[model samples]
Target: MRISKEEIMDAAKKLEPRLIAFRRDLHENPELSLEETETAAKVAAFLRSIGLSPKLEVGGHGVIADVVGSTPGPTIALRADMDALPIMEETGLPFASNRPGIMHACGHDAHTAIVLGAASILVERKERLAGTVRLLFQGAEEINAGAKAMIRDGALDGVDEIYGLHNLPTLAVGMAATRKGPLMGSVDRIELTLEGRGAHGAIPDQGADPIVAAAAVISGLQTIVSREVSPFSPVVVTIGSIHAGQANNVIPHRAEMTGTVRAFDPAVRRQLPDRLRRIAVRIAEAHRCEAELRYIEQVPVLVSEDGCLAHAQRTIDWLLGAERHAEAAPTLAGEDFSVYLESVPGCFFWLGSGPSDRAEDAYGLHHPKFDIQEEALAVGSAALASIALLRGQSNHSLLL
Candidate 1:
């Protein structure tokens, strides 16, 4: 007894008001990574309201609920991140963040709401369900630590397949997108410290100027993607922060830089840290300074399993019209959902939340002005519910 598109939509429509309220509440009371205590409690309460018991604090404020069907079958997981960014709210919506210096600018509020909506829809159809549906509300996605912690706490125990979605503000509302492989890039953190000698501002060759070395290293890093990496492979090396001298006259003995590296291919991702370190060290040495580099591989590339993606695509096409979905090009942006895909064969797709005709209303993710179109809540919930229903009907294994 598979649920139909009409049935899913009807349930989603009925839950729209509640979904919007949930999203707004979450948006108003934003919480940073690993400290989602209040948010977790709200989610648990919602799950309980749907007649499901959620395991709270699976991994430091993470929540998980299992909706077992009438009969035994394969288990499918639907995940949503429950964390906010550090940016302050500027959207000025009535339900804007009440917490200063924290905002749901990344659409995690909508993601969490949509998943809860799906849980309600799924719960209504539980009697006809063939398998179990695991609802995962993850924390710390912005810092890329939540997924790993949840997995360590047994979130993926006995899960056969998983699915998740992110809200894309650039795409028009009512549209969704995903690709067959490498939908998102791997993320790696980079830190470089250049050591030199300090001296008076007017010193004549009395001090080793690390600031000069740091500038040269930053410039040299730009060439890694242009020269070293394959032209076809996508890679990004950006130095987001740098700290050097304080005084106007004195040369600083140390300069520190921090940045990020992203790549879609595993080979390219693996080689980036070494290449970046080599570039920085050699450039620093050329300036008569020593360099220390620290590279931490944060998350792996998010590649959707073909079989699972096919299931998702079919569901999306049926629910939103075939033309409503597009094949998304691989992006350099990293998602912690990549961590979950590593353990279970799954597909991570994007839900469109941009304003329909008002281009000015659409703001990129992480921006203070960022806000999702409320209409996307219904679309996302329906899509997630349909995918779970479609996949639960089969005992098929993913072609990993």
Candidate 2:
């Protein structure tokens, strides 16, 4: 049976205040990946308070807690990110980040609180469950290594399935959505440097111009998506940074450019490095210079497992009913959740946190002023608990 909406609400109310405080506490002392010392300690203490013993620092800075069910069943894992971004806080709220140059602009604070709330309900209602529930407080999601680290540390050990959530600013609070296919793209960081002979600006023929070749390479890179890739498929090549010359009067010997490459399929993502490198090198050599291209694979393409996604949808329908559940378009943004899904069947979804305004381009996620309504916290908690309860009755591996 699906968990009742009333039960979800009841649990949310019971855990809301506690979670709010916990979120605020985390906000006041934000930490980056592999550096969340206090966050790890608090997560351990919170798990202990919930009557579950959580193993700490499993994957450098990962935390794991497992609650066995009353009956023999599978093990389901729920995860929350514990790291903050390197952004300065500007929300101006009293509980705003105390760390001057770091903030939780991605709503990980809400993710943590919601999971903890689910833990509280799970502890109190363990008899209703038929299997085990594992909680993963992962670090370095922003840096795209948390899930892999946690897996190495055995976070997914014996886990049959897993679930993750992200906060969406445009979708409105109390709502949730996701698809069974590619929910997010593969993220790769690319840096290119062009080298040429430097000379005085007045004598343009005296030296090869690296900046000129770099500019041409940047413009030509767009054709990769527009002409090279399949017409149906989408790809984005954004060169966000360019640095080189000290002044306009002199032609610099070197030009450095950095950008991100995003694609939905592994085949396409893998081929990007070769494609990008060739384009950069050829473009630079044509200008009597050379190009240095380096591709840093950050996050892999986030492919949601069909079985796990179906189960997640069922749990949502059971808890929120048909009216409250909806389909959503996938995004080009990437997530580290791909690592978790690799070891266990699972899906990562979004929870709408309402918008700042009705405008189509209103302040959204990752914005300094972006803030999610706190009530969504309750909704997220309920959804997480439902996943745990539903998994208890499915395939014995549902909990794994």
State the lDDT of candidate 2 residue by residue for 1-400, as single tens digits. 3345687678788788888889888887889888988899998899898789988888888888987878887899999998988988898999998788899888888888888888888888787787899988988989888888888888888998999898787876767887878889888899999999999999979999998999899988998999889966768899999999999899999999999999988888877888888889998999998999999988888888998888888777766676667687878888898878777788888887875355235467678876777777888888888788777674423321
Q: What residue pairs are clashing in model 1?
A: none
Candidate 1 lDDT (Cα, 0 to 1): 0.90
Q: Write the per-residue lDDT of candidate 1 for residues 1-400, one digit (tens) a residue.
A: 4456787888899999999999999999999998999999999999999899899999899999998878677799999999999998998899999999999999999999999998998898788766899999999999999999999999999999999999998888899998987889999899899999988889939989999999999899999989998989999999999999899999999999999999989988878878888899999999889999999989999999998999898788888899999888778999999899889999999899998786346789999999888999998999998788667665322111
The residue pairs that clash in candidate 2, if any, are 74-399, 75-399, 75-400, 76-399, 159-400, 160-400, 161-400, 172-354, 173-354
Candidate with top TM-score is 1
- Clash count, candidate 2: 9
Deviation (Å) of 369 in candidate 2: 0.3
Q: How many residue pairs clash in each candidate?
A: 0, 9
User: What shift in Å separates residue 372 of candidate 2 from its native position after superposition?
Assistant: 0.8
Q: What TM-score fits each model?
A: 0.97, 0.94
Candidate 1: where are CA atoms >4 Å away? Answer: 358-361, 394-400
Whole-model Cα lDDT of every candidate shown, in order: 0.90, 0.84
